[model samples]
Target: MVTLPIEFRTPLTEGDVGALGVLERDGIRFEIDSGRLILIAPRTLWHADACHRVANLRPYAYGRQGMRISRTTVRCPDVMVLFAEPDPDASCHDPADVAIVVEVVSPDTAVEDRVVKPRIYAGAGIPEYWIVDRHPTDPRDASVEHFKLGVSGAYQRIGQAALSELEKTG
Candidate 1:
């Protein structure tokens, strides 16, 4: 079995969060929520279209930003939008501050995105989560899966569409 680097498990402090916020890449400093840091990767045309749609929705959406939840610091997703009330008693991060969470599925990280991340989001009480799968025809495409947390502690599929469809709607 191959071992992935254990970098995601690093603990972070408020001071570290400040330092990370100033670390720039290609002229854009990343935003650190707790410990997980996010950087916006180069987007495909389809991605741009989807982003445009998401932007018009007036959800206070953010792309590539970290969200601090509980003890584990989750990496900022490809896109996250806030549509609800802000939590007053939030310590790690405000659950109510998050509305929709989207992830563009990559081959290396798809499983974690689908399996692991949803569980965390549900535990944090995030309401909506979207998983954008780039590969529709590939046999390995697990990308079509979209998961939303029910009142119970489980995820349910909401919608599944191609990248082109997502862009067109946006």
Candidate 2:
């Protein structure tokens, strides 16, 4: 198994890191920032039902696929709507083709989900980013915060929804 803190002689792109077999390892993800590689450890298993629900709402939407935020950075969103089907063997997706990126917040991931990821997604030019926060008393229920990237290149709060209250469209 590839261990943590593996050093690279040269800066590698997101595809190169994926080829090293770590991103395939359950839940592990990394980001290359300013030529520096940073590996983020996987959190314990946590899946939101809302993520799956959102995935099925539109065509070409997928769950947990890594998205290429830049030449050197890749981030996996909980759910993403890729307006078109990608090549079958593609390792990651380009943000240019992405319509929306969703993050399902777990107890331990609040800060990253609510702040860090939205900033990254916005910077990458993702048009929309949503945060699904599970209801305190009901695991099956969730609150979704929808953010739209505006003309200024920053995300603006566009709307909100309760999963339990959403009418089924599909």
Best by TM-score: 2
Model 2: per-residue Cα lDDT over 80-150, one tens digit each: 89879988787578899999998888777789888888888898899999888876667667777889999
TM-score per candidate: 0.64, 0.80
After TM-score superposition, the amount by which residue 50's alpha carbon in candidate 1 deviates from its true location, in angstroms, is: 5.0
* Model 2 worst lDDT window (10 residues): 40-49
> How do the residues 63-143 of candidate 1 rate in per-residue lDDT, one tens digit apiece?
655576654354566677777534534322356578777776655667867888788778778888887665657533233
**Model 2 quality (TM-score):** 0.80
Q: 146, model 2: CA deviation in Å?
A: 1.1
> Residue pairs in steric clash, candidate 1?
53-170
